[model samples]
Target: MHHSLFLMGAPGGGGNSSVLLIYLGLMFVVFYFFMIRPQSQKAKKQKAFMSNLQKGDKVVTIAGIHGTIYKINDDNATMQLEVSPGSYLKIEKSALSMEWTMAQQKAAEPTK
Candidate 1:
């Protein structure tokens, strides 16, 4: 009886162990697709947007200052923003907000 109980508690059941491992792997895959994958795609898009910034593009700073790109320094990863006539501030490239692409497109439309 003791031997049977010991066998029951022993880690020798390959069948059950394999099932548990398969379940864990499936769970990890599900979590990755539903949670991790989308976040990584968003990060990739944001990084591309940040790297493609250019002069004359209107942008808002992370600090909520709206301005146009006056200068771009690819070497230093910085931007000079023109907030107003004769008013400019140097800011890190990462501090820029999403590109105002929609507003620019609307402005470029021919008046009917």
Candidate 2:
């Protein structure tokens, strides 16, 4: 009877389980901070850049095509881009990426 009682009264193996749960929770927090937050921030910045596009702004498309904006049809979700003199292409607004902020800065620099 005392042997059975001793076995029943022994502490259950819950300490390891609780430690595992704590470890998993910490891993999730680390992943969110390192992997998820920066990506969301980049997406938000890209969305803002796309929304602020205007006519006559130079932009580079996602396919690496560079052009100047000839027209903006925000209602129709399209824009006309002049890739070269006397050459033009109609592309969706989403196709444009990475506005030429650095290019503009370079142009504004005084030539040596």
lDDT of 1 by residue, 1-112 (tens): 7865544443677556566677799999999999999989978988888877788878877677888889997675888999998899999888876645435546768999
- Candidates' C-alpha lDDT: 0.78, 0.78
Q: Let me know the TM-score candidate 2 reaches against the reference structure.
A: 0.74
Candidate achieving the largest TM-score:
2
Give candidate 1 misplaced runs (Cα > 4 Å).
1-14, 74-76, 99-112
The lowest-lDDT stretch of 10 consecutive residues in candidate 2 is 5-14
Off by over 4 Å in 2: 1-12, 74-76, 99-112
In candidate 1, position 89 carries an lDDT of 97
The true-versus-predicted C-alpha distance at residue 106 of model 1, in Å, is 7.5
